[model samples]
Target: MDVIVIETPQLGDRSYLVHDGVVALVIDPQRDTDRVEAAALEAGVTITHVAETHLHNDYVTGGYDLAQAHGAEYLVNAADPVSFEREPVTDGQIVQIGAFRVTVVATPGHTHTHVSYIVSDGTTEAVFSGGSLLYGSVGRTDLVAAIDTVGLTHDQYASVRKLVHEAQHDAALFPTHGFGSFCSSGPATGAGSSTIGEQITTNHALTDADEEHFVATLIANLTAYPSYYAHMAPANMQGPGPADLEVPESLDAAELTRRLADGEWVVDLRNRVAFSSGHLQGAVSFEYGNGSNFTTYLGWVLPWDEKLTLVGTHADVEDAIRDLSRIGIDSPDAAIGTEPRALAPDAPVASYPRVGWAELARDHAAGDVLLDARRTDEFADGHLIGAVNVPLHEILSRMDEIPAGTIWVHCGSGYRAGVAASLLQRAGRDVVHVDASFADVESAGMPMAEKAV
Candidate 1:
């Protein structure tokens, strides 16, 4: 069997296309279906089946659309209450594609009806474990609901153990999450795929002492996932429509202003330094960089149905739209491809001053309000003394809680701090962007404290 791994680094997820030289099957595909389609063409095989391990909570699935387009059978868990027509699959059911045999194994943990598929070509075996058994970690169990966390954690443990011990112990394991994904319970010990035998020895969930201890550790380690996750389940249940890959038309300053008047989101896609130097008033900053979590933050903070106008270059706008589409954000209402200064020629521009670690320490000592924009767990691990732990995602909502003064915002790295500084400036607060490493905070002789329990 020929197994191709399609990686979505933006969301830190993977999809698989397994073929046996004549016919192929796709598992847990993202909304961008062209990649999978191209792979099938390159392999000289027809896509005969598209299967989903579960209704995804991190991004929209392309299984239904791809199946419909290719006239392939779409498979989903029989227990999931989806609105669209699908070939509902149950446990132990085997489907044949050319010389490959794909068997479904019920592994409910990440979601109530999650399953893993084992594909074999008689000689070698491969397991398409969507969110169950990851490389070195397991999927986080709390995305569904708070009440279901303990129950799901228990299921996750049993599911991983079953996959590693009972079913296909020698099969190669490929999971959708855990490479840098927030969906994982914790960071994976390493990258790339692992075999069931290897995971059985190294995976924490599979090697834990007991179910109770595993559940506790799993639940305690879950950080605040993106707010966008709340919309994914319902969207998946309703069956997301076909994605539109076309870029939107560019709007001028007057048109953008009118839209902004109607409460549309005007996102500035320039670097933090450019945004901090000067940007249109009220435009939120989300710098487009390699490591920037643009989709997560934008989707988390922006209204789902509101019109969005993005301000960036042609290349920047195209890249942003594509990245956003992975998470069900198909298109923006309009995109401004000109430079910010050109578009907003006469508009009032805002700016924020950047500060170094030494200056931040002096400001902190002088009673200036310091805000740590990292996650709460990071704050608990180690943070500057007297700094408020208002994570970047919660900054806009919790603006009232911030003291009325010059706020100095810093994240573990400087990306989020730049985002927070823009939001604070837009809110009419005097802000100083602490654009330095948080690791240097303590090394610079600044007082630090652990989170009080």
Candidate 2:
């Protein structure tokens, strides 16, 4: 059997297409199905099965629609309380696809009704351990609130142990999370595939601690996830409609101004340097690039109920829409490609001053307000001694709490700090962006503090 890993780096999830020369099976597909179909076509096999590990809480699953399009059987756990029709798979049940044998194993931890599939051709075997057992870590157990977190962590432990015992010693370990995915409990030691035997010795969840200790560590490590996550499970349960990938209509200056006046979101998808140089008043900056963390920060910070407008080049807008769609944000009200000055000729252009780590260190020592725009847990890990924590997501709501003065902002990296700087500047606060690596904080002879236990 041949396995093709389909990676969605923006959301840090993986889908797999496995084939045995005659037929193919797709597991845990995202909203976009073209890639899965392309994989099957490239393999010169027809897709006969599409399986979902669980009702995903991070992104909309395209399994149902993809199955319908290909005239294939859609498989999901029978215990999942989903509204759509599917072939209910149960534990210990094996299904044959061409020369491959697929067995379902119940692994309920990431969600109340999650399962993993073991695929074998009677010689070589692989486990599609979706969100249960990652390479060196495991999926976060707090996503489902109906089940107590303690109970779910125990379940995760048991399920992973079972997978370790039941799979072939040489079985390839393929998981849907843990490649820079927020769903993971933490980062994997290595960002690649591992074997069942390797995980038995190396996976921290399996090797390092007992159940109680593991539970506590996992719970304590989970940081703030995207606000958009609240919308994914319900949409996936009901089954999401096929996404419309078309860019929205172009908006002129008047429409853009009117939307901004009405409290609509106007996101500028450009590099931080370009955004800091000149941008439309009130537009937030989210740079478009690989490994940019665009979707996570945008989803965490944007108002869920409000309509959104985007300003960028045609390619940037298209890429932004695609990234947003992965998090279930399918449409924007409008997009503008013309220069910001052209759109709002008379509107005042805004920019924020970017400072290096050494300058920020000096200002911090001399009593200037330093705002750390990182996640709560990140701030707790290690931060400048006098810096105040105002995570970028909570900045708008907690604006009044900020002390009156010129505020200097920084994040683990400059991306979020740049975003925070733009928001602060737009709010009429005198702001300086500490646009350097937070790693430099310790090296710059700046005093650091860990949250008191």
Candidate 3:
């Protein structure tokens, strides 16, 4: 059997297509089913089974729709209260598709009903540990509910041990999350590939035999996840339809200006440097590129169900749509161009000054507000003495809380700070983008804050 991996790097997740040269089984598919369908076609295999480890808390699942489209059996946990029909799978249940045998194992941690699958060809075995056993860490246990977090943490510990005991030491380990996904308890080890044997000695859950320490460490390390995650589970339970990848209607200069005037979200998809140099007066920067996390940040900050207008080139707009579609945002209005000036010829553009850590330290001002756009934990670790900690995701809701002044926003690497700076600038605050790495703060001669004893 051959395993094909379909990676969604934007969301830090993977979907797999496992085949026995004739029939295939797909696991944890994203809303876009076309990619999986294309993979099956290229491999000359018919999809006969599709399985979901659990109701996801990050993106809408395409399992229900994909099964219907291809006339495949949809396998979902028996305990999940989903609205669609599915082949109810339980712990220890074995299924056969062509020459491959699949075993379902209960591994509740990421969610109450989460499970993992072990697929074998009688000679070689591969384990699909969706959000359970990750590269180094395990999936976060708090997404289900705050009340169940402690219990789920313990469950996660047992689940990881269970997986290690059940799967062969040399079995190929494939996880749906932990590739830079927030679902991971902490930073993933960034391993491209691993096996059960490799993870045995390296994975934190395995190396740290103390269950209480493991649980406490995971809970303490859990930072703020995307606000958009709140909607994913409900949408998945109701059964999401196929993703609508159609390009949104194009907006002319007048329409773009009107939308801006009306205070709609007109996201400018350019690099941070270009965005800070020039953009539409009301357009906020959400740069689109590889490893940008464009969808995650945008989805987290923007109000749900609001009219969104994307401004960028055709390629950027198309790519943004696909990324947003994975998170259930579809049919957004679009304005294609190299910059805001070209998109809105008749309109006046806005620009902000970009500075570095050294410059900020050199031009010391008493009244200026230093806004730290990193997460809360990051700020607590160490930051500039007086920098206000307003994470990029919370910039919108907590706008009024930021002290009024010439706001100099900075993040760990300035990517998030760029987004925060544009939003502040659009909100009529005198903003400057500190486009420098936070690592240089001390070397640049900036004063560091001390932690509370």
Best by lDDT: 3
Candidate 1 wrongly placed segments (more than 4 Å): 260-263, 362-365, 450-453
Error of 3 at 166 (Å): 1.3
Each prediction's TM-score versus the true structure = 0.96, 0.96, 0.98
What ranges in model 2 sit over 4 Å off?
A: 362-367, 450-453
lDDT of 2 at 215: 80
How much lDDT does each candidate structure score?
0.84, 0.85, 0.91
* Model 3 stretches with alpha carbons more than 4 Å out: none
lDDT of 2: 0.85
Prediction 1 global C-alpha lDDT: 0.84
- Among all windows of 10 consecutive residues in model 3, the one with the lowest summed lDDT is 183-192
> lDDT at 19 for candidate 1?
90
Q: Write candidate 3's Cα lDDT for 1-453 as tens digits.
A: 999999999999999999999999999999999999999999999999999998998898988899999999999999999998889999999999999999999999999999999999999999999999999889999998899999999999999899889999999999999987888886577588999999899898888889999889989899999999999999999888988787777888899989988898999898989989988898899999957899899999889989899888889999899899888898898988876777788777899999998779877589999999999999999988988899998888899999988999999988999999999988899998999988878888889989866
lDDT of 3 at 40: 98
C-alpha lDDT (0 to 100) for residue 218 of candidate 3: 86
RMSD of 1: 1.7
